[model samples]
Target: MAYQLRGGGGVAPDLNPLPPEGGEQAPPPAAEVDRISSLPEKARLRILSFLPLKAAVKLGMVSNRWSHLVNTPQWPCDSILAIHIRPATQGPCGCLVPTHIRSDQIMPLLANELGRRGRGPGHRLLRFFLKVDDAQTRPADFYSLLDYAADCDVEDFYVDAGLGPPEVSFNFQRASHRLLRLVLFGVGVNQAHRRPMSQERSINTLEVITIENTSLGDLELKWVLLLCPRLRTLVLRNCRVLTCVDVTAASERLVRLTVAECPQVDKISVSAALGLHSFRYIGDLLRSVALPPTCFGDLRICFTKATLVDPIQYHNWLDALPNLSNLVNLTICSNALKIMSALRNRENFQTQVAKLSNLQNLRELRLVLYRMNTLMLSHTYGFLRMCRCSRLRNLFLELPKARTDSFVDAVNGLAEEPAMDGFESLVKVKINNFQWQCIEIELVHFLFRKARSLQKLILVAPKGTNPERDQSGNAIFPDLNLLCLEKAPANVEVQGAQLVLWL
Candidate 1:
């Protein structure tokens, strides 16, 4: 957290007062205008600090002395560098008119001031927040200004711009060593820059990077992998257009990678990402890439739409995970389950589970029933019950968004798993949006009869239901003393279950 900002919209309240030169409160005796104009140079700098990054730098025009101080060399390691266009000056309402400056004049002026200070230290956070409201906001203008920051070694660069000429790129001479979180909007990576991108550079200190709402036309993603060797987390959301992507040798040192909402990335090329710890992807795994992945930590995939999936066809992915034994927690969502559904028989299902069954260390199993329709939820739950995960101690069931249902049938299916004779290690169960039909009640009762070590049962119930109704003698689970009903109304009558557990 480079620096905390006040007010949510990236600007402080009391816009007219003019910020002091630093971060502190000024005394009242100084009076308004007197305090602002008469304050010591450093004090004025403190006041200016309160102004948003844009307004603060603009203060150079207020006075020659102000510009001198604004140009002072210091490591601005935590300033959000906003580049959104607005009228030359703010309006009367104190709210800036959303209108952007048309000419490319502001960049040269602003860049001259900051660059005159000349490549000081890397600002721990430099956000280039641009709003693409018109065709006039050239990508070159934005890129040149960002080029200045990349030269200065900005750590966090967020670019929300428009699609300009296809021939565009930022060739950082030394490669940004501190660049961490990089977000883009309405831009594309040209093929011309692909090779230089693959050329190894020193992005040794980078972390989380995201590319959003844009098209990565011919951008070789491998550059991000090879060049940014220390990167641990990445996200590319809504980048709807991409043709070729090769990320084979790119996985040197990454812990988390998230690729959601990117409709066009045709294929994912990876041989074995040795250090990859977690992965979240929505697109199909292109046959070009070997599977039975080597990612030893966690894998999460979100396939919101229905698609044909065959996990066994890519058995190489499963086999590639030499350390599948090290793979502990597995969350299979829409796309993943779709692939698993392609299996023809229990033998195939057992083969799939067998790869991970050696993970005796596995403890938590989360099943997201594409709870779209009642039938879908039933089938999902039925498919899950077929697997024998003796080590599972916790289970989570998620419902599809908007396809609302209190899935009592699915809950019953879980309790019906024939293996429920007595799970010695099993202790807890959590159901999100839990609806209690007789199936749910019987499931609860069944847990009491089966899980000898069972201790907690959590349910999310409908709003306004009095939990006191659940304390009846008819309720089972004499051992079920801890009932955590999250986000319902205030709970009462936990006494009977407690008394029974003690008895």
Candidate 2:
């Protein structure tokens, strides 16, 4: 007869029978044994920590023992608790209409959750993600939540107010040392606050910090960096108020840095970062840049404008590239190509190309194109000719949406250049947003003729465009037949052409 397991509230059967009237009870039946209940409490808690907070809460319904364990102060360790405050109603158009949610309405719920955890030395939280979609969220609520997370020894803390205005100014004077990653989006920084002597501390455990869509000044940015002594990655995007980013103080441990869309940043100085391996700057070319002399493994410089109106400033930035020699991978935008092409006839154009040739170690190159025109296409070819093609192994080209039917005529009318050596080392070429237009086919043909070592060609279709079905429910491009059968070269492997559809 099966017996009920003790403390299981009649939910699970005790597989071990009273063996032969207390004559050495047989080992518990392996198939029906409760293996999870046999593990230590710490091990079980660790397994539960991998689950989401909602799933952990639902696990309490299994049995009374589980319910008690889940309700304990140390139930969850290294778990994530995400709270999103986005109250909405259905609109007439069947869309979600965001409704106003006050901070007072959310504070009580947060308090109740935090109270249940009973924060102390025993509790630990891995990540605390809080996103407020309401514009009325007060700064005090953020502070209280941060305090609660610190009390629980949270490791990763992410706060996003991007759905609303940038009104929350965080004061990091009392930041905890247990934080390993901090991400703040659409949040400002309080510049006037100073840490008191009794609470003065540094977040030495932080390894990554990302700030986006925030209004931060240079002094405040430096102040935040100074508090994190072990930061390895720092990303600043769309921070309009930052004029300069000087990471000399935090350069010792910095390995990667990215600054994107910060239009006002005039200068970026990273004095002596021996460990920096990757650096990406995406915006207008900076007026001043001071980087380490070490060879970078990856580098990206993407200009937002098609052409900078000022010729001198444009040439000055191009002249600065030779100093960053020996990059393994490089990504540039069509704008840089356009600017460089305009100087094709000038004497310094060759000089610029020669300087760029200093990057003999470069292997991969990515070109982000905004439009497909004859001028830009010619510039792209010229830019490739400048690089050491024998060493380049990968080529990535991002194409914009096709708008005009004149592109085919433009490609046909383009002048032919003298035959040159092909890309002997190119192993892969990827084209994103591929439209099976005449110009795209012509580009593929050009690559087929030039890249002698080409092994794989990746053609990614435009978003939501299916290669399997057409608008009328007809089979379209069965097995990507267009490229493999008609366009691909005979010598090159046509089966290597891959079609990717982005849903």
Candidate 3:
């Protein structure tokens, strides 16, 4: 979820207005300009807090009193790093925040400021954000801030710096102990700088860290592993530039780790499963990846391509997780079926998906087959025969391009197996992005007959190129408690109950 702006709906906070000081100052408009200084104290603080860290401090010119408040320990501080822009045909209306602090200014400010105010409840600030606005951030500025944060025992450092090639490349050993959260977005560091980061943290002091599109070498990551002993949450996205990650700490306190869009992470050996319970790995090539025998509990993996070199490699990787038999929720997606048709690997590969039948604690399963030959879904019934999950109840499948006959055969095969049952207990089934093929309708009919325990069925309408090309229709669902159809009429009670319709 995107963080809501302080004012909601990403609306910017209001700022104080000022009259021009130069001789070129133009005449004022008829309406009065309400300056921030005129606002009440609490309101004024809120307004300043809403301002990006850079702009907030530049407002020292608002008044000397305001300058003191800007540096007060009660307020929040962030790096003025990010920049966003929007344009119009007429012109551009942009919001630019520039910071002017350098190493010299920040050092004294910390030594003097913390000396007077001190830490504790009085120092209990909400969050510390690192801005990356180029307006006034110099390379030296961050080094000083890094050192200052180390000395001050700062925690919760949030960084969004588009730093110069090597703006900040130091480590935090002792001083970084109190740090809890580290959020890095588009923040790059000098990987060549193998210089040891003297800063090493405790076994579990690090609570959570998020990184996106940032390039950090394995050495640096391993450095963090040694320092951040008590890592609870780690999220890495689009960091495919990294090929090696030392997850040696997976055996202790780490609870959740999510990695996505990292194409380079082919081998994931969880040597030390730690306190890990939730693990999600989604990337380009999942076939070659490895998972340790320790990884267990809630796990999710997705693949839209069949480029998996060895299909069984993934199953072997899954087997490595100790508690695989007890997975609560499992989701598998493959969009490569279309490409697989030409290769003839579909028949052999079907066994790979069925191998997931061993997940005993699996209660909910969502399978998405994108633009792949949906007919291959028939192979899933064999999986049903192998599955021993008695608690399975909810099933959701998305076959946007599945051939109609294949869909029908899949359901029919499942129903034919008497011992392979979920009929009376299965409550929900959803099929999205339906193709208008005849087999698609047949599949729906087959589901109505096979799923006696089904309470709800949803058929999502296929998209139309233009609004004019859309079709208006409703689908029949006999013996079902609820049916949801798209691009149809209202909730007309056709038979037993009114099926929900969306246009």
Q: Largest TM-score belongs to which candidate?
A: 2
**TM-score (C-alpha, index-matched) for candidate 2:** 0.73
Q: What are the per-residue Cα lDDT tens digits for candidate 3 across 1-503?
A: 11123443133333433436773545444333433454556666666655544355677666775786676544534311222211112233343323333323444655675456554433433344445444344456555555445454455566666533233544444335456677777665434325555533253556787877777666667666666677788888877477755588444777787887877776665556556777887766543444555536677777645555655434444344454666777666653332233222456544444445566667787766654333444434434545656677777777654343443443343323324354445677666556544444545555567667677765555444211111234433332344343344454422122223221
Candidate 1 residues lying further than 4 Å off, grouped into runs, are: 1-119, 122-141, 161-175, 190-204, 217-219, 243-245, 292-295, 307-323, 334-353, 372-394, 404-415, 421-430, 433-503
Residue pairs in clash, model 2: none
What is residue 212's positional error in candidate 1, in angstroms? 3.2
Error of 2 at 123 (Å): 1.1
**Residue-pair clashes per candidate, as listed?**
20, 0, 28
Task: Provide TM-scores for the models.
Answer: 0.59, 0.73, 0.58
**Decoy 1 TM-score against native:** 0.59
Clashes of 1: 20
The TM-score that candidate 3 achieves is: 0.58
Clashes of 3: 28
lDDT string for model 1 (265-353, tens) is 65555445566777666665544434334635665555565654445664544444444556556666654554544552447455554
Worst 10 residues of 1 by lDDT: 494-503
